[model samples]
Target: MSDEGRRTHGFRRRTPLGAARERLLEQVTPHGRTERVRLRDADERILATDAVAERPVPHYRRAAMDGYAVRAEDTFGASDRSPAQLRVGETVGPETATRVHTGSELPEGADAVVMVEETETRGESLTVFDAVAGGENVAPVGEDVEAGEALYEAGHRLRPSDLGLLKSVGNEAVEVYERPRASVVPTGEELVETDPEPGEVIETNGQTVAQYVERWGGEATYRDIVTDDEAALRAAVERDLDHDVVVTTGGSSVGERDLVPEVVDDLGEVLVHGVALKPGHPVALGVVEGTPVLMLPGYPVACIVNAVQFLRPTLREVGHLPHTDPPTIEAELTRKVVSDPGTRTFARVQVDRDGETVTATPTRASGSGVLSSVALADGWVVVPDRREGLDAGDVVAVEDWEWSG
Candidate 1:
């Protein structure tokens, strides 16, 4: 049996989701393009090379507090009962001290700092009430990082705080992998951008996919909607051959109007034309001119579901980014949800919290065309192929599907 309807002529065999993913991923290689970017603009960029500190942080010894810098021995054996007497001078020497503020360079011959509160100033002399050992209150060279130290290895995903550390170590720019490029093409005959007539509908899949691509650490370009003509679809696909991946929102089914698989096959090859996944069995994975192309169904929910399961991982793989799964929560099912056997299903559910009890209720609109069913739901409960259905009161792990978006 197929993922959605009765086995159709369009797809002779529907590949399992796990098998389809593995087949497509095995052909993907990490992006090799690298660019040098300034530290300020390098946040979230994947490092292309290992980073090493060229210079030591705080290259000089500095005072760590506001006080007088003096030789350690001058403040030794000093206390409230019998304070040590030291002469105030321009430079630190034997029995002499110089005033220093926090972060100030330590004066020559001074090995310690006596806090201002610990001593009192006298005419041409200073009173020390605390005994400071050598190197006390003094930050030595390379205190934060040593020169020639390894900072981050290659393939490290940089964060804002990491950039700060890189800058402090004298890095103005660094090398990073270029973000994977994607072209989102929406195709359908009865689709419009804005107001739709009685027979026409508003186009949404391309815009939705483009945004998701960006969020997944890839660069996305949303193309205008193409009609259901084979020539137009072929031209649209060929135009974006330079991108790492191309995604089409319509014309993926086996019907006469669905011509993406044929168009892709003409240029290169279709790896998998159908997948064993609910709400999106018509999904197709292919490669054209060395670039992976994902063909999604025209239905709103089906397009979104296929994009999350297939396109999301494609972007991460091509961009050399880590694929992080959305967090899940275990909740009691308020109602039973029937699923087609042998087909992986994603059931939209609204979650409610009461005191400490959490419950998930299946949404009323479960059809593939009902976009609001998934949009308004909190998360989704995945029903594996093995189970025919989930009973009421069954504890299910509901994934926060849109959390990453």
Candidate 2:
């Protein structure tokens, strides 16, 4: 066979996920700009610096329940059999013991809290049965978090709970990293705008990519749906070169209308042409105008998977945010999985953990175009390329579809 025929038939084999990821990381450099932002607008933003508590949480000692506070010694040795009676005026000051409710502060000279339920009220005196302990129902100062302590380290992503923590620490404003901006371009001749006629497929990748970008803490500032024409693709990519990151879908493979690689070569350098993973083998990475541009496959599943595997991590790395792996658990396969020995395969699976056994239901369709399988799956199983296949009842690691808690 000629070199062209051999190249067309089989030349470069698929790499394993680990090796592919390493190569990608080596090719791409982190974005080198950081800006400070306010906490109010810092939701999902990364923390460029560690946030220390401005002051001790619960700055003052507060009551935990509404009850009269008194010295514990005065109520000791008091029981139902022989109740101890103390005059209200002698035991506590005026307006202190007459009536108390939950979370009421203890009056001066009182050292312990006596619950109302433990005492029987009379005309001017009260009968006490149970003994009380000092500081039993009080929330001491700095009980939850100490002053000058680090609340969150640098590179932490601010969540709702983190905002609440900031509020508790009397922090009205906090410094965080500015959100990175991204541009998305979807290219395909068969794809039409969301509102399309009968045979044309509606453009869904842009919307999906935008949503995923937002969820991953990057703002999709530019979105354009272009045809497979090389000129249109190059123009769209050039327009989006000013963004921190640019993403284009379709036209990335070795087809007649595959203009992504050509445009990248014309505008900048192509870092990678293919990855060693199923559903996203034709993924491309490039740099243009000092901004990173990722060319993802056209299929919905392939696009989504590549977005998570590549784009999400890149954004987090450049934004100085911590990236966590998807939740995972051990599960037993319900059936066998036959796969090639070249690429790492991600199989859609439905996982249910009952008692100690986790059952995984493999989906029938694993095609890159099958978006429904991803939606229907509870998680996914990673089948290494070196392994021939997974037998029924084999225990494997299952990565959860969504982050839980």
What lDDT tens digits, residue by residue, belong to model 1 across residues 1-405? 233432365567889899999988877777799999999999999899999887888889999999999999987799999999998999989999999999999998999999999989978789999999999999999999999888999899999999999999888999999999999999999999998999999998889889988888889999999999879999999999899999999889877678888889898998998888888999999988788999999998999889889888998898878788989999999999998888899999999999899999999999999999988999899999888989999999999866553
| lDDT against the true structure, each candidate | 0.90, 0.76
Which structure among the candidates has the greatest TM-score? 1
Off by over 4 Å in 2: 1-13, 27-45, 64-66, 71-86, 89-102, 109-111, 114-122, 126-140, 146-149, 194-200, 329-331, 350-362, 402-405
Error of 1 at 22 (Å): 0.5
TM-score against truth, every candidate: 0.93, 0.79
User: Against the true structure, whose lDDT is highest?
Assistant: 1
TM-score between model 2 and native: 0.79
User: Candidate 1: deviation at residue 200, Å?
Assistant: 0.9
Model 2 per-residue lDDT at 39: 62
